[model samples]
Target: MLSTKEHADVFRELLRKGDRLYLVPVPGHSSALPEQLAAIAKNISADLELVETYADVFAALEVAVEGEKKRAIVLCGSLYLIGHFLSSINN
Candidate 1:
């Protein structure tokens, strides 16, 4: 999810151990930087990866999928981030 660290902290209970989390920065917006979000994930001992672009996200997703096992991918946080993701995919 592309959100602030504070927001994640409040909803941190939703995170479980061993979850693979990829943190991406939302440039020029009021969101948690990747490093900031990574701190929270590290606190819970979650597997975390920081990526710079949507390309990196897709690359990570490709590696994350094991065989034919379907995995749920969630893209959340602010409407701005959602818009950014949608715009990226459309292009």
Candidate 2:
């Protein structure tokens, strides 16, 4: 899991590259509000996609990669989603 500062740093770097970023809010956590997240994206000039479920993240990444040929997926929200994806990839 990444610390808040690490996450922020990664987000900053990703934004500079203009990459499409998806943020899946962790269930039961509300510190990262949608509007705030969107505003952050807008501030950094990067596209932001909100994902409400783990499945949504997978589907979105698959569609973006297969349909749009995007090669990287930067998930910036929800440690649960991050663990899920990491476990899947490791397995």
Candidate 3:
């Protein structure tokens, strides 16, 4: 929805997390999001884990939440992305 790269900073702030995980989409699927979002995570700290699949994201979140570290998981995506993860869980 945006043509400029600088505007990503706003989302970057909103998306900041204790330890962020980026679910990078496959090539040609707005692939720029990986780098853009990762930059946001790096702006907060030196740690950023970029995983390529929904399962990896769920595993990471499970570990984080189970650790009792009070981490907030923010999922920002279209309904299709949400459905993909949901389907993964049901199978």
lDDT (Cα atoms) of all candidates against the true structure: 0.56, 0.52, 0.48
- Pick the TM-score winner: 1
TM-score of 2: 0.51
Best first by lDDT, ranked: 1, 2, 3
Q: What tens-digit string does per-residue lDDT give for candidate 1 at 8-88?
A: 564376556545666565645766666666666677654433222333345545655646366566655556766776787
Off by over 4 Å in 2: 1-10, 28-31, 46-56, 86-91
Residue 8's lDDT within candidate 1 is 52
Position 44, candidate 2: lDDT:
59
Better of 2 and 3 by TM-score: 2
TM-score per candidate, in order? Answer: 0.61, 0.51, 0.47
What is every candidate's alpha-carbon RMSD to the true fold?
Answer: 4.1, 4.9, 5.2
Quote the lDDT for 8 in model 3: 50
lDDT of 2: 0.52
